[model samples]
Target: MRTLVIGDIHGAYLPLMQALDRARISPLDTLIFLGDYVDGWSQSPEVIEYLINLRSSYNCIFLRGNHDDLCLNWLNTQQHNSLWLKNGGQSTIEAYKRITQPTLQHHQSFLETLPSYHLDSENRLFVHAGFTNLNGVNFEYFPEMLYWDRTLWEMAMALNPRMSPKDPAYPKRLLIYNEIFIGHTPTTRMGITIPMNAANVWNIDTGAAYKGPVTVMNVETKEFWQSDDAYTFYPNENGRN
Candidate 1:
């Protein structure tokens, strides 16, 4: 079966559907979404609904992103920080409003149950943000590594003899996994960056919700696919648009 790893959607429903259509994804294939599924765009509700429906029809893996975590937190407490509200949480709130009580509860449960990181038998790891390694240490605790700390992961990727470190936040891991698929940072192009790395960590976040492409990569063959449309974020007069 072909395994397709998709980057952050961030509620860009049209582009996501376009990417899916272009890729010709099928039920037999496995689609692993790297999270940040909601927020950013105006169609947060539609995007969530589409993903929820897609799960029933195909083999799909959904991981929790930082934004997803914020949404869950707000749902439980009815309040959140400015970071959460500033980072497209308003759109998610609007999405939640359209749902009935039972459906809202179900969606909350789904978000809460999402794994922070997923590792396959082939040693490929999928995480939303990045990880931290302590002295050749491999963290089996997925949640902390997946969503919270990124210092060690950044250091490992940066200092490693492989790729030239672009961001100081990138970490280096001594025990390299076969492949690591990550999203969170937005890139202008859909193609793989840090290609010189021996560790095979691929950043597929093409910034679909912003001025960039929505990327998808075939894990086994290293084949890539992207959406045609480009998006950009513009701040309004009040610093929100």
Candidate 2:
């Protein structure tokens, strides 16, 4: 069975569906989502509902994202923060208005249950943003770092290609996993719209919240598929731009 790692959706539901279809996903396959599934576009409610239903037939693992945590807080308390509202949360709030109360509760439950990270038997780690602990994720002192930190990716990006794992200066976080997969920060920031690899870490977020496409990659084969540009599907909206 193939393990497929999907990037952030950011409420571009149509693009997400297109990418999954292009990948020819099967019920037998495992789907690992890097989170930030809501916000940015007009389909936040739909995206959450679809993912909830998808679990019935597919082997799926969901990781929590910082935005997701913020969204859950809003769902539970109906409180809105200026920071979240300005950064795509307003769009999600608008989309959720159409959802029934029961469905909202279900979505809230789903968000609340999401884990911060997932470590597979093969020692591959999947997280939304990253973890900073020298001893690895389990030893991370700040739990929020799992979904909000960028240091891990930053370190990976700055790592010398020639650095050996045995080198004392090598990052212990990167050394803990056979491969690490993350989203949250867009590869588009690095001026690309595809998955990026630095050291052993793979970043799958291709900036679906803006101009890039939603990406789906097979962890083992490293073969990937992408949808059309996310903004193209929502031409009327300024999706997190």
Candidate 3:
């Protein structure tokens, strides 16, 4: 069975479905989704609902993202960071408001149940962001960092491009996992709009949150599928940034 890992969705329901279709996902496949399932677009509720159903038919692993945490905080405390509203949280708020109370609760409960990261039998690590100080073979100690650290990716980027993955100075975290997959840090911010690889880590967040494409990769084959530019489908709104 193929193993597919999706990038950050950011509430683009149609694009998420498109990427899934392009990837040719099957019932037998293992699907691991990087987070930020809400925010950016008007379909956050729909996206969550879709995932809820998807889990019943396939092996679905959903990881928590910073945006997901922000959504949860707003749901629990009835408050959120001001920047959250500006960064696509407004759309999520409006989407939930449009749904019935029980439906909203379903979404909130789903968000709360999401794990910070997932480790597979092959020892591949899948996270919304990356880990900072992970204990080898037992990586969940720094659970918060798994969903919030950018340094993990930054450290890999800091290495000289010429250095091998076996280089002595390689970040310990990257060396621990057979391979790592992450989202949260969109590739577009770096002026490129595609999945990027540094050492053994892969950044698949191709920036669907900011009008870029939604992408999914086949973890084993390293093949991937990408949706159309997200903005073209929703021409009337501006995504995050």
- The numbered model that scores best in lDDT is 2
Question: What shift in Å separates residue 2 of candidate 3 from its native position after superposition?
Answer: 0.4
Candidate 2 lDDT score relative to the true structure? 0.95
lDDT of 2 by residue, 5-94 (tens): 999999999999999999999999999999999989999999999999999999999999988999999998998889999999999999
Q: Could you tell me how far off, in angstroms, the CA of residue 183 lies in candidate 3 after the best superposition?
A: 0.3
Ranking by TM-score: 2, 3, 1
Using TM-score, give the best candidate's number: 2
Ranking by lDDT: 2, 3, 1
Span of 10 residues, lowest total lDDT, candidate 1: 232-241
Clashes of 2: 0
lDDT digits (tens) for residues 11-126 of candidate 3: 89999999899999999999999999999988889999999999999999999999999999999899867899999999888888889989988888999999888888998988
Off by over 4 Å in 3: 134-142
Clashing pairs in 3: none
Two-way TM-score contest, 2 vs 3, winner: 2
| True lDDT of residue 144, candidate 3 | 76
lDDT head-to-head 1 vs 3, winner:
3
